[model samples]
Target: MSGEERGKRAARNEDLFRQVNERLHDLAVISGSSEPHGKFVCECEQTSCSLLVELSAGEYGAVRANDTRFLVFPEPWHTSPEVEAVVERHDRYWVVEKRGTAGAEAEDLAERGSNLL
Candidate 1:
């Protein structure tokens, strides 16, 4: 695939991860309480990875505050160069934000009605 295609794919993968987290958050809300911390699958571009990162409700909220920001395993960006930067790093996970066209696509995904988390 071309570089553009790879970028698009990376952005879409991030959106998919965001959707999963949104659903998890909704479930937590309905259950009346969130655990002190919960495990969420790493939302990186690595298809072979099944790693789960632990995050507190507040931590997840911070990541959700930005449409382009995604929670990923540290160094996933090394393999997925489409990611533009590492905006934040926590003990368990890293926050990556897309750039250029990929960033725009992620923002668009956030605006969708289904993305209301």
Candidate 2:
């Protein structure tokens, strides 16, 4: 491709990144809500690629998988290489961001226990 075309592509990618951030904030509002009537975390981006996502704003949060809660997730998310990859996947078309507490934290508070992780 020509240099000019590449530059435009990069600019477009940057805009998508901003959109992802905005979508994350919107999803946070829904995910952080007290009720679970409808889904709040919808995939924000849809691509011709296999992984299609919807950016939603309301639903139950994922605090654990299987029987585990309180996962030791890398902090800041931005500095985590794997996480950054998820966010930059599809050549910047798919960006993943997280907000709010994990499931284990909620469960712990309910039981009046400390979050082990």
Best by lDDT: 1
lDDT string for model 2 (66-92, tens) is 111211112233222221123233321
Candidate 1 structure quality by residue, lDDT tens digits, 5-115: 777787777778778877777777678774777777788877777677878888999998998888887665433554468888778899888888788878877787445
| Best-performing candidate as measured by TM-score | 1
Clashes of 2: 15
| TM-score per candidate | 0.84, 0.26
Q: How close is candidate 1 to the true structure, as a TM-score?
A: 0.84
Name every residue pair that clashes in candidate 1. none
* TM-score for candidate 2, residues paired by index: 0.26
